[model samples]
Target chain A: MSLPRHVIAPAIAVLAASGALLRRSRRRQRSRNPRPASTREWTRHPVGLVAGREIRQRLRSRSFSISVLITVVAVAAIIVIPSFHHTSALRVRVGVAPGTPSATSALITRDAHALGVVTTITSFPSVSALESALHRSVDLAVLSSQELLTYGGLGASGSSGSNFLTSLSLSLGQASALSAAHLSPSQLQTLQSAHPFRIVALHPPTPRRSVDPLALVGVIVMFMMVNQYAQWILLGVMEEKSSRVVEVLLSGLRPVEMIGGKVSGIGFVALLQGGLTIASALIASYAVGSPLVQTHASWTLAALILWFLLGYVFYSWVFAAVGSMVERIDQAQSLALPFSLPLFAGYIYSIFEASSTTVSTLYRALAYFPPTALFAMPTLVSRGDVGPLGFSVSVAIDLVTTVLVARLAAGIYRRAILHTGSRVRWGDVLRRGR
Target chain B: MPVLDISGLRRRFGDLVALDGLSFTVASGVVTGFLGPNGAGKTTTMRAIFGLVDLDEGDIRVDGHPVDAARRQRFGYMPEERGLYPTMKILDQVEYFGRLHGLSRADARSKGAEWLTRLGLEGREDAKVDELSHGNQQRVQLATALVHDPDILILDEPLSGLDPTGIDDIGAIIVERAREGRAVVFSSHQLDLVENLCDVVTIIDHGRVVAHGTVDELASAGQPRLTVRVEGDREGRWAASLPGVTVSEINGGEVRLVLEDHVDTDLVLSAARAAGRVTEFSLHRRRLSEVFRESLS
Candidate 1:
């Protein structure tokens, strides 16, 4: 903090005098007619200053430096490894009855391939063989009947055999009735040509797990990243408070500004890391030149970034304020334990929802809360549970939660930072009486 | 007008009366030393005045108005424990403080550099704060307090870790600030520095003001008793025999005698001459330290 005497002396003298002069002017006004001192005009918010300091300090630390490297590698691995994956496209296996060497089999084979399946057809002559074949069903199959003219689809369920069975029964009954009544030949021909529309489509209950795999990956990734970075905010605040440097800042600026600045600055850094991860994942994936990159992965990555911001804001204040309550760095983790509970729950729930393709009301409720929203919303978006309306609701809730929690945290910090004897009690902090 | 106007301040921490009716005033352009022993509420008092600590009773005003948002920005405070970010570069830390005190970015940066130079920390501006010697850290701390050009500086234990050179660095800067008409208040255990630097002092003990006002006023209140020694007076038993005199010490050709305050100086001198040639005479106006120690005890 020094310069040579020659340069510093003049500058000091000028500054010292000017500072004195400015002070005198303010004093002179009060002497003539005093105004209230606590007025808003006197406020010099410490937000930007403290935040900028925290950011610059943290950026220079070994942790942030190391974390940057880790984030890049992790992102690269996430994107590149997926692109190189070999077992992604879905396929199916099938079985065919023996002695069925015909063009009908070739047509069925062609249709199976078109339906995103790789099929294999084999013979099953005996009941045991047929049962084995049924167990290894190729999604659908053709079965031969005893009578040549009147045959039925067997073993395979639904329309596979229903229409054929209906036709066989009709032929048998028609033959018996013809023997009994000597019916007209024109009517019989009419029945044969009656309705050439014999299209039978089999419907199965929808697949139990049809949720997009891409959405699940994105939602899980985002939830984990946001949770990881919110802790960064917590740990950052704890560092500042424990070092007591924040006290020097508090003297000049209000706690709101201080906390706000810290959240913004470090939050910006966290946001950058989150964005970088997404970008790296995209770039590496694109560089790998996988065709599926844009089809689904891109949207999930974007949701992850947005979720990071909303989540950071909500949890940062809670963590930051909780930080001020305790004075030592050693106590930070324990103090942070309760605050991170909601976040942890959100992360776990999101993962469960993604894998099971089933959303929980608790997770949805957590989503509306600011701290967990960063995790839940992105998960929902990835799970296709979020649309325009749900997004609006979550965003609205996030904003409100941010404002309210910030205010609450600021109040606690302002009161507790200066009262340095012991950890502040939550009830005392919230109490109206000082 | 006084730059700081504090009156009727009373505060308590639970059952402990941390500040019992603490109040004083500081005018611009003079150094006011806040004097107190440990747990005497010196730090607490300063914090309360700066609006960092809430008060239980009475109001503290700056420039005749209550100290509040308007005036707090203009006040610079350095807490007693020497708080600073250990990892932050010297220049960055000071500049950050400047901004917190409301200096614009460019202004903070330039002023911060200028302050670093003035603090004799020019080359070390880029060095991390904790890496510097304790003395250098103290200088940086001072820079933080002064960087914003605060109208009023309330420093707690400003000279604790400073070397003689570092002490001079801060003392010179403070004297310079006071000369420029910015009110400066600092507390220190170093009695001589406070005696030399402060125009007015408030000595507190057990959360109560034991003494306040000028050095002269405190001295007078304690009394102006002088100890004199005469070469031939020997044990000064002869001086003790003198009217209105109590001898307290004797060595070689010297004798320590406490002359009554009401007694005339001429009489003591004449009595000393009668015993022998008076060699040494020292007048004591209750060394502030004595009062402080005795009060605390």
Candidate 2:
């Protein structure tokens, strides 16, 4: 599938940036100047080593591959299903009484076409026959040149059949009135154009009043991506600790480097899977010509990716720290609750608030909070409820909070990682023991 | 000069003092046996030397320089908790640890293979750690510790769970590393192995150094004893007649005697000769296990 120019251009820029970074690193590696070993150079070796291991392990795991496959299929189905339902033809059947003049049929067809509805007209021998035909074959019937009969239980309020009947009656009545006035064709045209009315509202229309389906998709994808990947990191850390592999790791590397490497490594995997899902959706939408995917495609996608990284970094550390405290998998469930509760709340709140015309006070507050910002800011931006200033403030809040949470989590992880056996309590870890 | 020197190291976990003024020096080209009873702080001392445990009141030096992260990278540590990633391949796991210790990727890979081959894990490089037997996994753990050819090696209870053959194999490896001029300090409860393999032994009890010397030096530190055998003294009834000699054991023609502090060796010899024609006579030193028990008490 072909990517639109907007998608391809950003992807190329990202590739170019990464290539430059790689070149710079290689040049540093090859530099001939004799320099004393710097701290960054020394630490980079172990951190890179650890991150490489994490990336390789997860990327090669069967579960990761299977999950990616399932997610791609699901995303493709989402993109393709809607186009099939909405893009088909809309036609209404109108049965005419057989003895009625052909001019009435002509009027019905003309008005139906003017209103953008396709029509199929059938002539019946009698009014009873026309009424009977409405039940079996026609959507509505024009009986004896005066009355309109609709099929019982077939036409609901705001249905195409009701709309077609209303347009047909108005067209017929207007033609009769014009004939009674003895207006020429040019006079009729002038009269029809003479009294066109314009409507005015006291309040201005809301910007982006229509709900963007892409943003709704973005919110759901972001919530699931962060929640799922954060748990992966948590379970991975606990497994290493429970299996005692962490002891060997800590002996050679500092706690911060190890946890940092793990977070980045798993974060990379999450991004990879997320990118695949998005690409699948884009390609599927392009293939089926779905208008939903084309609406604000570039900005919605970029926002989703940015918020995902921020959210993942914010939560993955908390999970990693908690993982270090628990000695077994069973203890992880309870410990993970407090960390995941806010994420769930934000997800539910965003889903309910994304479509509302007016933003709620709670939503505005949540948009500024780091944990919920991942859900809130993207929705508000997609809905045009947030301006540039608001978006910047939300991002700044998330970044600052991420730094603080990272520091706190690293401290706890370092203190409790080596304390094996029973689950370590937060009180004991914070107090002292190394 | 010693390769690793830990002096007056003090550490406490809450109110319990894990290491109290513990001091020792491990010189290159020798295996230093770190011996202590269960809670005697041998493990803690090893950890402190590697900079794993922060000392509340002491310092550690390597090669006449204060130990830092760079210097600590030159040392390898195997904790009492035997750890290996169960799902990781043996070769990859070993090389990963080697890289963590600051070896280049190519060097780590080659050295990892060499160590694995030396530890008799030659054909199982591709196998996951969980697939191996407990003894084999222990061997792999040692290979991981030694993969980078560390200048100093600290192994805690390195032979605790090893079978007879596994223990012998690892014992040979440890001695071989020492022969290559690497300072090796390992703690084990098997006094016999320590006595046979270590060039010097340090015994700690109650978090302090109680005894530190060669096996011969520690053994000789105890009271002098004599083992005497007389052809005609079946029950050694005549041995008790000695004024300053106390008979500790008598088995048929043999009599073991502990001499008083001021008693001369000639007096014990004369008493044995007087009782009956002396067939055997030798001065005896205590075994390491006996010395360990005495040191703790």
Task: Return the top candidate by TM-score.
Answer: 2
Local accuracy of candidate 1 as per-residue lDDT tens digits, A373-423: 776776666555656556666676676667678878888887776556677
Instruction: Evaluate model 1 with DockQ and give the value.
Output: 0.32
Model 2 segments more than 4 A misplaced: A1-44, A82-87, A93-110, A113-115, A120-154, A184-186, A203-208, A289-291, B227-258, B264-281
Displacement of residue A423 (Cα, Å) in model 1 is 4.4
- Docking quality class, candidate 2: acceptable
Clashes of 2: 0
TM-score of chain B of each: 0.85, 0.85
- How far in Å is the alpha carbon of B223 misplaced in model 2? 2.7
Model 1 misplaced stretches (Cα beyond 4 Å):
A1-46, A87-209, A284-303, A369-371, A386-398, A419-434, B206-208, B220-222, B230-278, B282-286, B290-297
True contacts kept of 2: 0.52
What is residue A78's positional error in candidate 1, in angstroms?
3.3
Worst 10 residues of 2 chain B by lDDT: B46-55
iRMSD (1 decimal) for each model? 5.3, 5.3
Best by lDDT: 2
Work out the TM-score per prediction: 0.73, 0.85
